[model samples]
Target: MTSLKLVIIFATLVAVSLAGVVRRDATDDDDDSGEEKHHGPAFLEGLDAATKDKFKAIFRDHSLKGDAKDAALLKLATSVLTPEKLAEFKTHQVEFKKKREQWKADYDAKYAKLSPNAKKAADEIKGLWEKDGMDRAAKKAKKEEILKSLTEAERKEVQDLFPHRGKKPSRN
Candidate 1:
């Protein structure tokens, strides 16, 4: 592969790894909501424990710095994302994006038809989310209240549209 391509790949992996680590650290509290934060391929869920441990070891190597770090990361990415696997992942991403857009459109259409009270509740929840300085639990509780305002069918439709809802999260 081209040197620039390798550099880009390495940089992207490092950034994702760093973000995951930081997010994990920030949320490592007793009050954490039982939610798994996943920001990568679904195949990552299929990796065996031994392979996952090897990947962790690569990131934990403190001696690797600068270009060495980049090189090591690139090597790791190359090994993990084989040509066939990468092709499948790219296809999956494209399909997922299309499905997400369709779901958003459906939700907008359904929401536009809600009764005045339900609409008002949804608006209040949106306002709460957009405002700064609100605690997560409070916001979530308020949002749930808004959902409760909806009819049973409407509530089920909304839950169905959300990819992360109504399904057990895979352990990282």
Candidate 2:
């Protein structure tokens, strides 16, 4: 639909405008200025300046997504990543995956106890987030509508449990 295309276009524009400021460290330049530099993750901290820039560019690229993105990153890492660092990073990755799985399981347990209406609203909000071509305003409106359909107690519980609730998204 024309509206869907327009929404995607608008979202892209907003992203472009924010891109420069979103990542101060993603840029290739070495800043000698007094301002504090954004330190990369612990694993990447061991890499040299030029190597860091190369990896950063690969990571910043929008054209690479999903498996393609992972492959690109891995190829770059293969070149310069030390064996010890690779083992350390892999350990961290496994730990992260486990933590995420546990969190999802805990949330699912909580979700199972929710009222039918609450579950419906939660599903609608999750769908809004997952749906392609959904602009922020459209998602916000949809979420508000879903929340309004619930009773006061239901609304409070839903809002309290929401992943996005009470947090401003990170600019970095």
Candidate 3:
């Protein structure tokens, strides 16, 4: 599971970095011509000025340019992400799914034993989660209340089962 999570996280980072590259290249289009410009790899756009300069030096070292540079970067990425590594990730993913299912089953059993009012609140939250018109802040507050009602073990299990879902992205 950890391996799968890491792959997902890495893929997300790569996509975001590539998006920065695309956005930067899009904005720097030549006014007089329709030809697409080869700005280094999309990953470079996400770096700070100093980091960019450092990478520029490295690019010069290899004498990679335009399409060749893109191919080089792609080759580098593929080489690092080997089939064996991906197979390990798949194994971890299967283990994680099994564990998450067990946790969810436990959560259901624990939820059934909650006090009536807590159960009511949980049901309401579940209903709201299924539908979509509620105010975001109100839904968040209700969700927090529902979590607070859980036993410590249940809460921990829930957190472990979905660690990334509720988190906000960190500022770089």
Tens digit of per-residue lDDT, candidate 3, span 54-138 = 5456466434544576455445444443565435434544665687678678768867676665566666666766556777688
The lDDT-based order of candidates, best leading, equals 2, 1, 3
Identify the candidate with maximal TM-score.
2
- Which residue ranges in model 3 land beyond 4 Å of their true spot? 1-81, 144-172
Error of 3 at 129 (Å): 2.5
Write one digit per residue (lDDT tens) for candidate 1, span 106-160: 7788677766666666667668867667887988987888788788866665454
Prediction RMSDs, each to the true structure: 20.0, 17.0, 19.6
Q: Estimate each model's TM-score.
A: 0.43, 0.58, 0.36
**Best first by TM-score, ranked:** 2, 1, 3
Regions of model 1 farther than 4 Å from truth: 1-42, 45-80, 130-132, 145-172
* Model 2 lDDT tens row, 75-131: 777777899777666675566568767877877887888888888888888878777
lDDT pick, better of 1 and 2: 2
Return the number of clashes found in candidate 3: 1
The C-alpha lDDT values of all candidates are 0.67, 0.75, 0.61
